[model samples]
Target chain A: MTEVTEPAIETVTIDVVLSALADPVRLTFVRALDAAGDWTCGSDVLRETGVTIGKSTLSHHIKVLRDAGLIRTRVDGIRRLVTLRYDEVEQRFPGLLAMLREHGPARARGISSPYTSG
Target chain B: MTEVTEPAIETVTIDVVLSALADPVRLTFVRALDAAGDWTCGSDVLRETGVTIGKSTLSHHIKVLRDAGLIRTRVDGIRRLVTLRYDEVEQRFPGLLAMLREHGPARARGISSPYTSG
Candidate 1:
């Protein structure tokens, strides 16, 4: 059994959380995790988000989020399940995740640019 | 008169805003600006936040925030006045600055760590 590590919710900083979520793919992952609970690595989550990236890249992004204390990863046999620390993060940063949940999908869709036509 | 550049509010992306605010000093700046409204660079805002950073470093952080579209800067005589684009940011990603305004001070005070004593 591989032991997964994560910081306590109170230990997380807004700075670290912001840094973790600064990437497009990771933001998409968090939005997905918020909408649909526990997600397995290399699952349909990526496909659902419409993001094209290598498996190693996705794993790296997950590692960053885990290190930032915004997520929990557990090993269920050979598969690793990822869960967003939504409530914990909300306790620490209040409305951060709610804002992400509301606006993140439009960002992930690359429609955040003002120059782009609707 | 030096020209100050910033992205239009609609051009701002949540990712850039998060990256801009990931730093402690920058976060403090935004929080202060949010609380006090228009602030002049090189003013007592730093003293208020209790952050000890140099002038050049502070300028760099301000530039990051400005480029990220989280702030608007205008040259007011010799002083560069900085203002949080509060409404614009709120329009782009609702609840983001409100979250920062609500919880940012605690994070700035270095009390975000669970290991720290209250």
Candidate 2:
């Protein structure tokens, strides 16, 4: 099995992060992960996010998010787990996640996440 | 003179907005407009924003922003005045501008605009 590694926090650029979130499907996926709290099983992302993209496409989106350092993935036996790298991202871009969560249409859909003033 | 109109606010999508903000040069330009507060002259944008892109490319970026409903432009004699569609964007995405301007790398570089907590 190939090793699963996330990009270093310092390597994550704002442009890359924004680009990753620029897709509606990816944005929705991030919101679902955000709503998941600690971590979410990889399979649940599509169901929770309601993204219509197929499994292959979803895997691609997940790769983009992970490459941008927006998320972390852990390999647990056959099942993989994913979680938002909220603290690292917030530290790098400051209030970005909160801003999107608070105001971007992400929060208004499935998850009524508490307001986070950026 | 062709009538210059920005895309309607309702038509603006977050994906487009994020994609518009994804480019480093364009993000810098938006930051300059944010610092300018109101109606920055087009010529001043390149100078003020320090975007090194050629004129044609800058125009393209401006068009993308306009199409995304992130900005507005007005024709004044030979000069075109461009301004951030702050209120409309705020109503649409809320805290997005503030996120970039407030904590984004935009403010840390040159203009130290008053901190806005998104």
The candidate maximizing lDDT is 2
Candidate 1 lDDT at A21 equals: 83
Candidate with the greatest TM-score versus the true structure: 1
- The reply for model 1, stretches above 4 Å from the true place, is A42-60, A105-118, B1-5, B47-54, B105-118
Reference-based TM-score of each model: 0.74, 0.72
Local distance difference test scores for all models: 0.75, 0.76
Q: In model 1, what is the error at residue B50, expressed in angstroms? A: 4.7
DockQ, candidate 2, vs. native dimer: 0.34
How large an RMSD does model 2 have? Answer: 6.5
- Give TM-score, chain B, model 2: 0.86
Cα TM-score of candidate 2: 0.72
Q: How does residue A49 of candidate 2 score in lDDT?
A: 49
DockQ of predicted model 1 = 0.43
Residue by residue across A1-118, what tens digits does model 1's lDDT show?
Answer: 3898998877776777887887778887887788775555545677666679998888888899999998899887878889888778878777777777666555344434222121
What is the lDDT for A97 in model 1? Answer: 78
User: Candidate 2 clash total?
Assistant: 0
